[model samples]
Target chain A: MIQHLIVLPVVLPLVMGVLLLLTRFGSTGLKRSASVITTLLVAVVALALLLRASNGEIAYYALGDWQPPFGIVLVVDRLSALMLMLTAVLALGSVIFACGGDDEKGSNFHGLFQFQLMGINGAFLTGDLFNLFVFFEVLLLASYALLLHGGGKSRIQSAVHYVVLNLAGSALFLIAVGVLYGATGTLNMADMAARLVELPAERDGLVTAGALLLLVVFGLKAAILPLYFWLPRAYAAAPAPVAALFAIMTKVGVYAILRVYSLIFGDNAGNLSALEQPWVWWMALGTLVAGTVGVLAARDLRLLVAYLVLVSAGTLLAGVGMGTPAATASLLYYLLHTTLVTGGLFLLADMIGQQRGKAGTRIVKGRPMTQGGALATLFFIGAAAVAGLPPLSGAIGKVLLLDAAEAGQRLWLWPILLISGLAAIIALSRAGSTLFWRSQDGDRGGAALPRPQWVGVGLLLATSPLLVALAGPVNDYTRATADQLDNPDAMVNALISGNGDTP
Target chain B: MESLYAITTGVLSACGLYLTLRGRTFPVVVGLTLLSYAVNLFLFSMGGLTTDGAVVLDGAGDYADPLPQALVLTAIVIGFAMTAFAVILAMRARGDMGNDHVDGRTREDSEESRR
Candidate 1:
């Protein structure tokens, strides 16, 4: 049972998703309890994995007891464990939020949600490139279904663009993998990295092309400039709980970039060393600027929050571009803070939209709401946290990122990051004033917001202050994760490192 | 033989890309299908372009690389499912929005309909 812990994150979800699917005719109360219990179990498993990984040991569980480089392996390190924990907690919040009546609009909501969690956890845990692609499809399949849930004209429109763009992206992903495999003759990332170190000079160009192709694929996922046009509409049109769960989807792309580059193309890979640096650096800054402009341009509250996710993506990608352990640590900390808060904001926006009669989430004047004061307080806390105002998790995350940037990177990161923060604050304040303060008093018409809604919003939004309080231990964990990532030799050597390149 | 294989894959990919760029959903789905075929072929050839090789690893000369075949199989299954989903989505988009333009809008829909 103890040895099976590593695979539990992936397998438990698979089993639960299937079980939930079988109970399609079951009561919503039963389904919700089942999903909530399963997510809680996943969180507990993730916590255990996190604690074990903190010992700095790299262990991989081979499916079917198959050996490395031959059979699929699920590698657990500090980073994977951290991401798994994040996914589980975020999923828990989203699932609970859905129980507040979002699930009733669509069939198989609980089932699809569980499958989405399965795909996400699998992607975080897998060590093989091909396996990663499969998990990506798993997640994409689930996301496509979830996106169209409680469908409307707008949802249909956005889903078309999202699906088409992602299909292209997946094709590109396959081509990249094929190129890498042809050049290195292995799909296991550890094995690929080991072979790359001693790759004959003839294959350098092939490997470089593969690496760059991979960057394009991940960039599309992370919603960097030139590939982000699909994100805002798709995210904005999605149901609130579904959109909140999607907060971590971009992070998956960021994680892929970090993992592939650091492990396969790191210092030991000879000519391929840090080849992703310049491209990611320049593109990341462009994304930061683009995200800020979007924030200012946003006319809808959901669109604004979606743009905020983009800003967070850019900020994290900048840390990736910096290519230092300290920067990695800082970005990890920021990742934890940003994912939870943005997810909470989406749920809160839904609550606010519910009470606003016809204005919905559009950033315009609306009639007064019964829970205006309560909603205002939550909005203030969320906006402050997301915009990097002091005494919140966002401020701590930004400071850590700023401190990690050295002289050269600081030149660009400082002004751009600071200005983005100011933009966020300005945008959020304008939105808040239109939402809460500017509204006229009348009937205060709209159904009373449900209890589960408040609980769900609180569960996610409260993470901001909690992260601030637990800054020390969280920072240590992130710092350690960074150190572990910086050293890829441990993973490669533990795998089939000495077997040399395949034919 | 190698050049022939490479050229075929390239042409298929080029056609797929052109199709995907078209204004309608049907052509786009066909294009994605074409592209996936190209990808599967490309992935298959990655193991090497051997015609007559041992299927299993008997430790003989030119034993076939089974991994790429396995990979192509998975890709085909996944690609098939995606194509099916894309078709259904296209149908639904047309049914719901009353048009099959990829953006769910036709020319002269008025300014307010535009994003």
Candidate 2:
């Protein structure tokens, strides 16, 4: 059974999604419990997968016994396993929060949410490029539905822009994949890496174009500077739970860039080695600047949180742009901190909005919350963590990335990243004070938030301190993951050997 | 023949992109459809375009590469679903916002200098 653990992340959610769809007319409680239990199970399994991966072994599960370089395979390295765990945890939180009543507002909420998980997990795990595209589409399919869930005029508007942009992105993804396949005659990433090492000079131009095109697709996913205009509006308008799930969605793109670039075009691939680093650096810095501006400019709490996602993306991309194992490790740590905290903040925003009556998540003077004290407390911790203040995960994540930067890169990275951190502090404190302290005028406070909602928010927000507490082990894991990623030969060999796993 | 195929894909993509940039959702949906069709054709040609080639038979002489065909099939299915969803969403957006404009702004709003 453990032998099948690799495929479990993809299959379990898929099966559960179908089950939820079949029982679409059943009690909402059934769907919620079933979905939460399955997500928790996947989380546990993801933990096991991470443990198996911790030992620095590259493993793969080939579907239908079709061997690598020929058939589709799901590869589980430290990075993919770590992502599976992150996605599962985030899904658990979002699903629970949805049960607070958002799920009831839309049809197939649980089902589509599960399918989204399946797509995210599948994207993280797949070794085949085409399979990755399939997962991207799968996740997009679920997201487009979930984005329009509990449809509002703003949602439909943002969904139109989001859907149109992503459709164009999908077309670009297919073209990139096709170009790469035509050039390399293989879609398996490790295989592609191996082939890239020996690829003829004549094919270099084709490969370069394909590789860069792939970067464009992943960049859109990562919401880098130019391509990120759609993110804040779409995220701000999404149902809070769906928006939280999207916290990991951007990380999916960052992971692809990390995986594809570091593995296929690493130091071994002669001319194409680190081809994307220069592009990524400039884009990352630009994105960082843009995010800082967005963070400070945001008026609504949800929109502010959404811009924080952009800030995190910029920081993570900068780490990737630095192009060192230390930078990769640092970025992975930051990825964990940002994804969870931002997700918690999205849920927190909803909670605050609930209590504000007409004020509704905007940073304005309004009625105080019924659960004012608890909400303020959560907001305080979340703000401190997200702003890169001391005694939390965000500060450590930032310090590690800064420490990892090379001298020449440091000149560019330090000021921008620090300023972005400062921007976050300003925006978050402003939003917090407005929501908590300034709202003394109106006497409207909704009923106390639900039990599940608190539990859900607690699950995600609690991870910040936990991340700080667990920093040692987590950093070690990320460093090892980076080391594993920096060297692609192990994966190539592992795939070539049909068993492709630990003995 | 290969040039013709490439030209067709290029023209379709150009038209699709132009239409996609239009302010209205209907044009945007139609543009996306054209774009997907172009992508489908491009994917089909990725396996080294063959006029008379068999993908199913094992070890057949002059056989077409089966992988690209399989890939194209997946892309087509996904594209179809996306187009269907986009079409429905466009209608819903029209109903909700009282405009088919992509940003849901009225024609007058776009034409007017200031609100």
Candidate 3:
């Protein structure tokens, strides 16, 4: 049963992706039904995994029944299970948005979308470093296909950069894994953590170098500073639903960083403390600067949203870098908020783009409040929430993160966070002022927004407030999850001391 | 023997970095390949080289670390796939844009949008 839970997320998507590919020959109804069913099934399975993990047990499933230090392991602890659940939810939302697109392109869209989810779920669940590489490949391959699904010139150009940069990162990841394996004598994460402590002091420098190399690999994936130039361009050029999906992909990289840093490196037994602290701070600060600048400099609505993602990622990492239990909890909460809000904003941008595309104008020329009234209202609400305005999930998470940072004596991050938040608000307002506030000159004809456009934005808007209203339960869960993440002794003991027999 | 491998690793890494910082895509790819080789060798040495080491463990005397070798094998395969994907994408980009530039058409897009 435990093994089934561990494999279900990836296997379901893998089988469904293949099945969806086969069913492409069938009717449109069949593809839609298959995709909707598959996504919902994944969501349910992820929820079940989260519930199981909340019971304070770390479930490990070893491939081929091989013991530790030999077999690849799939771990479903509170942290990973939560990320899986979030991925499933965002995936479901993105699929729905995809379905709402022009039906002629639905089949190919759904197929590639499911493949991307397979990669994400696989990345979240894999327990060994090498297997994580395979999962990253799976995700990137799907992204390449999906980014080009719309087949526009801009999309293709962006996809090229996206593919090239990620391939470079993947090569570095491979080298890092090779070096790590050489030093530790094992690929199993738990085993690596155990062995890292016993390595000679002279080897510590080598180990830290290898770890930093992996950091660069994950950083590129996460869109941290210096390696993030590719993200906004690539994401902005892709179709809206695809961009929303890409939003979650970067977080998957951050999730890997968080998981590996805390569980394998930051474990009390390791010498990573000397290295992890300063590295985290520098990266986090750099991320904040990059994100803030990216958001402020964007002119396009989609590009603005993409840059805001960078900002939120930076803010979340700042919290994580603080490395306190409270900060980690705040980081987890912020992760959830940022994923949802960014995803919602991207979906809204898609709806706006579709409206603009249909209207044959660069500017929306109408009384948006009256013409696209409901959508305009919902868009503002969602955008405001994302900008960390009060009475939303984003605000709740920001407050917690700020508190945690202050408590950790990283108060200087507070100003950067505040400025970024202000910049996000300014950018959102600028885009909104152009998009929703301004009336078109009489020469330009304003078109009516479609009802389908409202549906996607409306769904996201409705979901954003729940993150705030449910903050109590969400915060508690995130806090408990962070506590477990910060101290993985229980997890390590379970994996090492499990019934002493191969499955 | 260890010192020789270290020197080789340093030289390969330097060459890889030099190539990486080049402006052209082809040279960057070459740099990446060289860097990967250096990385693999460096990782292999972490298991500590033994002249008469065997990979198999049938009571073999002083079997070299199989772990790093196993990891390097995966890395090599993945690295090859990465290089293939990158080269294909580069080909596609050049075919599309009629140039081998890495920055894509951002300048063109900005100028066109302005016009």
Predicted model with the maximum TM-score: 2
TM-score of each: 0.98, 0.98, 0.91
Supply the global lDDT for candidate 2: 0.92
> Between the candidate structures 1 and 3, which one is better when assessed by TM-score?
1
lDDT of 3 at A444: 31
**Against the unseen true structure, what C-alpha lDDT does each candidate score?**
0.93, 0.92, 0.77
* DockQ per candidate: 0.88, 0.93, 0.45
lDDT of 2 by residue, B1-115 (tens): 9999999999999999999999999999999999999999999999898887876676858888888889999999999999999999999999988889898997798779575
For candidate 2, list the clashing residue pairs, or say none: none
Docking class of 2: high
Query: What is the C-alpha lDDT profile of model 3 across A2-69, one tens digit per residue?
Result: 45777889888888788778753577767766887898999999999999888777888877887666
Predictions: Cα RMSD each = 2.5, 1.3, 3.3
Q: Candidate 1 at residue A484, lDDT?
A: 83
Candidate 3, residues B1-115: lDDT per residue as tens digits? 8889999999998998788777556787788788878877876776778888777769757788776777677767867877786677667777777666665544566589899
Q: Candidate 2: where are CA atoms >4 Å away?
A: A23-25, A442-444, B56-60, B113-115
lDDT of 2 by residue, A1-503 (tens): 88899999989999999989985456878888999999999999999999998898788887887888887889999999999999988999999999899998978999999999999999999998999999999999999999999988899999999999999999999999999999999999888998898898999999999999999999999999999999999999999999999999999999999999988898889998999999999999999999899999999999999999998999999999999999999999999999999999999999999988888988889987788999999999999999999999999999999999999999999999998888888888888887888767656579988888998999999999999999999999999999999888888889875546642
Candidate 3 iRMSD in angstroms: 2.3
